[model samples]
Target: MKRYARILAFGAALAATVISSSAAQAETILKASHQFPGGKGDIRDEMVQLIAREVAAAKVGLTIQVFPGSSLFKPNDQWNAVTRGLLDITSFPLDYASGRHPEFSATLMPGLVGNFDRAMRLNDSPFMKNIKSIIEKQGAIVIADAWLSGAFASKKGCITAPDTMKGQVIRAAGPAFEEMLAAAGASIGSMPSSEIYSGMQTGVLDAANTSSASFVSYRLFEQVKCLTAPGENALWFMYEPVLMSKRIFEGLNADQQKAILAAGEKAEAYFNEEVRKGDQLMIDTFKKAGVEVVEMSKADYDAWLAIAKQSAYKNFAAKVPGGEKLIEEALAVK
Candidate 1:
């Protein structure tokens, strides 16, 4: 009878432990938010979903519930929202936080890194280390850094030279882009990507500078008649940050953190692949839409670069704190 009683007690303890573990697993749900629309099917959205799905699959007692399209906070407010623990996770434009850390704005500066590969390497280097520290100081963790390829879409003729941009009102999204447009002799208007089509239709904007992928996602080709052929100019790339709220991250177990980081690294690779492919697709889509795509001459490209070096770089470095160092490091990337 004594032996039987001991056996029963052990069974009960095991059952209780199993139930407790189940409860712990069920309780570990992470809420993630993004400015991109949930149903958009864009690369950013796809990458975020990939992270969520993979993280959950790892079964690290964590699940990520995504709130996309700024459902929880506006695009510009996402960084602070995550930092303040209002959200568990978020992905936002790093340049959008320029107001908080001017060095972050360096991501948007024209002609910083030559191409996506170099840009990605630099982002994972010490250049990003400084920015990461600053972002962490605001109470968030940077998991992934990604970029998009910028292109020129217009309603009129293809823009082949810097001078062609003069007198045209171009819509620019971030600060560096705004400066880039203004320096090129085009009037700049700050507008969200969602409003771009309407802006073009209403004559509020004559041309716009944005990622090739975004041009397709936003369906700007329907309104714009031309796209400077792919690689016509240095594509304006925007740095995207996949961040986690420090409070929530700190609450996670070490195993869960490892799972999340692993998922993030995978997502980063997938995100870059999608961006590169999407950029090419956008260029192809533009050509199919009867849009005139023009390639600028090397001389023209050099001229624009010269203007960017003289005006965009000088002005950006002067205004943004640590901007010079950021530029120096970015350019130094081999």
Candidate 2:
């Protein structure tokens, strides 16, 4: 009888232990938000969605719930949400928070990133290191680094040289670009990229500058009369990264964290492969719509760069602390 009692007690203890372990390993769900069209092949939305799929496949008790097209949070408001842990993850445009951190203006500075190759190099350069450090200090960390090449579209005419910007009201994505456009004699209006189509439709915007993917996804080809596609010397490039709340990430178990990191790597690789295709698709979509498409000539790019140096570059160097050094670091990437 004593032996039987001991065996029963051992079985009970094992059952309790198993229950405890299962409870400890309960599924964790992370909420991710972005301002891009969901289920429509927008690469930005797909990046977050891909991470969700990859992490779930790892079976590490992690799940990601994505809220795209600003359903969960406003586009410009997402940065603060991630920092404060209100949102677990986000696909954020770094420049949208330039007002909070002046140094971020450098991320979207005019003519800073000329093309995709330089963008990849800049990811590993001191410039991005500094930017990432700031992100960490602010309670967020970059999961995937994405640089999107953009173009200028106008209902008025093609925006090629600084002189062409005269008498046009344009939506430049960041302060640095705003300074350059204003110097080039274009009127500046502040709005998120998601609103560009409506802004133009309502006659509030005569021209706009944004990512090729956004231009395509938002169907801006229907609104603008002329599209300045990014050619060899692309001028507009912005760093839009997948970001996670540092506190939330740190709270995750080791297996969960590993899954998240691996997913991020996959998402970054996917973006690099698909981004160029997005640009071409925008060009084709616009041309098929009968909207005139043009590219900036080498001379035209040089002219814009000279104007940016005088206005955007000069102002950034003078205003933001260590801003000049940041620009120098990016330029040194070659």
Tell me the TM-score of each prediction against the true structure.
0.89, 0.93
Residues 29-112 of candidate 2 have per-residue lDDT tens digits of: 899999999998999999999999999999988989999999999999999999999999999999999999999998898888
Best by TM-score: 2
> Which pairs clash (backbone N, Cα, C closer than 3 Å) in model 1?
none
Q: Any runs in candidate 2 off by more than 4 Å, and if so which? A: 1-25
Give me the displacement of residue 327 in model 1, in angstroms: 1.0
Lowest summed lDDT window (length 10), candidate 1: 228-237
lDDT of 1 at 278: 73
Error of 1 at 186 (Å): 1.4
Indicate the residue-level lDDT of 167 in model 1.
85
Q: What does candidate 1's lDDT look like per residue over 282-309, in tens digits?
A: 8788878878777667787777778877
lDDT (CA) per prediction: 0.79, 0.94
